[model samples]
Target: MKRSKLKWYGAKSELIELTKALIENGNLKGKQEDIFNEIQEVFNIELNNIDQAITKFNTRNQENETKFLDTLKNTLSKYIKSKLEKNR
Candidate 1:
């Protein structure tokens, strides 16, 4: 099947974190670079210097390190709550 190329405009760190999480959780197989290449092909985005980006993400202050993941959690929580309320 042909895949459409969707551009990713978010921070590279966020994408890197997500990629690592997928691998760590056993949701995806292969090395980081391989996964990154797949993502790039699928999304038509360029992800360069992944190792360096990950290093920067790790060194960030506690509050900023997982900002994107935290945002996702909060957004999903709100969506679930809204759905539950609507079902009442």
Candidate 2:
């Protein structure tokens, strides 16, 4: 499948915020203890410049989305991909 190249500014920031909310609200279900940390690791890159940050976030989000979809079960992956489609 061909991946779309549209970019969303502050998506990493949005991801971090949503992940934080899920953790704080205990909204994530079973085996989610380290999931936020995993997302954090993806956000930890040193984007010293604004352009760098934007580029890095876009690149990482694309990579992470690919991996996330690959790991999801058949029934759930489409749901996730659907949510992502709105942002693009």
Candidate 3:
């Protein structure tokens, strides 16, 4: 697949978190490392030391740990609400 010009500016830990969620929810199928490798390939970014990154992410305060995912949830909720309102 062609690599996108878009780059992931968020922390690698955020990607790791998303990857884990996808796998756990059965949205994605594969070992975490393999899925992460595909993500890196698609984004054309290298994420080294994933184990260390995950460790650091887990050690963060509760509110901070899933910051990116929380933001994603909020953003998607707003978008859906806006669409629903537009159709009402």
Candidate 4:
């Protein structure tokens, strides 16, 4: 089955290019399980950053800003998860 392209701004594009570069530069030379585990760690780090950002924005319009950021984080994380699952 064909996978659908994610629409989380440049995140998915950057991720794909980085994965390509890793493979091309032989940085990703490892067993499939090892690679999958590494990718999961990357996603977890990114998600934590998003969580931090959401907490960092505490200005007047905090609720609005947080909602927007939460949306972005959800979409981005979802995209990353989909890409990993698709590859598997």
Candidate 5:
């Protein structure tokens, strides 16, 4: 059977929370480009470059992460968690 794209309830909110947490923890410093690359690499999403990645993320209003995309999200989330822990 074919699988459908994952439908999340509060993906956008979660993204916001994740962003805020990363910022508050200063985990967002010096890794902007690497973060964008991680998103593309983990999601198999092709973005032109770091700026495009930032633009895409900034332009999104409210969006849900599909199954494959969720994999990317989780990967990033783990990265943030690790960073937060490491810095503490």
Candidate 6:
């Protein structure tokens, strides 16, 4: 899909605030529809900027996911090894 060009002035700032809100809230507490509506309300004017922000957010999210999984795997491996040694 073709991305709309971002509106520079207030749009970028609004998008930044929206991004921060999402990150801080993480699992936004509300009905899915309401949450979506809120997002739409915020980004409706600056749809293009929203697209750009989403792309960046997705990239960061993937990186964070990889780091989290790696940490979890290492922790589990150590825990399993300790248990096995104790059982032996």
TM-score for all predictions? 0.84, 0.27, 0.76, 0.30, 0.28, 0.31
lDDT string for model 4 (1-88, tens) is: 3433433344533443444446558889886345644554655423224323323444427565444446657999999999999999
lDDT for each residue of candidate 6 in 8-56, tens digit (9 for 90 to 100): 3444534454544554578576654466445555545424454455456
Total clashing pairs for each candidate: 0, 0, 0, 0, 0, 0
Task: Identify the leading candidate in terms of TM-score.
Answer: 1
How well does candidate 5 score on lDDT at residue 62? Answer: 55
Measured by lDDT, the strongest candidate is: 1
Give the range of the ten consecutive residues with the poorest summed lDDT in model 2: 45-54
Please give, for residues 37-59, the per-residue lDDT of candidate 5 as tens digits.
45445444444544444345556
Clashing pairs in 5: none
> Worst lDDT window (10 residues) for model 4?
45-54
TM-score of 3: 0.76
Q: Residue 36 in candidate 6 has what lDDT?
A: 49
Tens digits of per-residue lDDT, candidate 1, 1-88, equal 6875687788777888888778879999987778899988877778888889888877989998877888999999999999999999
lDDT of each: 0.83, 0.50, 0.83, 0.51, 0.53, 0.54
User: Lowest summed-lDDT stretch of 10 residues in model 3?
Assistant: 1-10
Give a tens-digit lDDT track for model 2, residues 1-88.
3444544345454554455446558877555446654544455532223334334445776556434334435548788899899889
Model 2 CA deviation exceeding 4 Å by range: 1-10, 29-33, 37-88
Taking every candidate in turn, the Cα RMSD to the unseen true structure, in Å, is 1.8, 14.4, 2.2, 14.6, 12.5, 13.9
lDDT head-to-head 2 vs 4, winner: 4
In candidate 1, what residue range of length 10 has the lowest lDDT sum?
A: 4-13
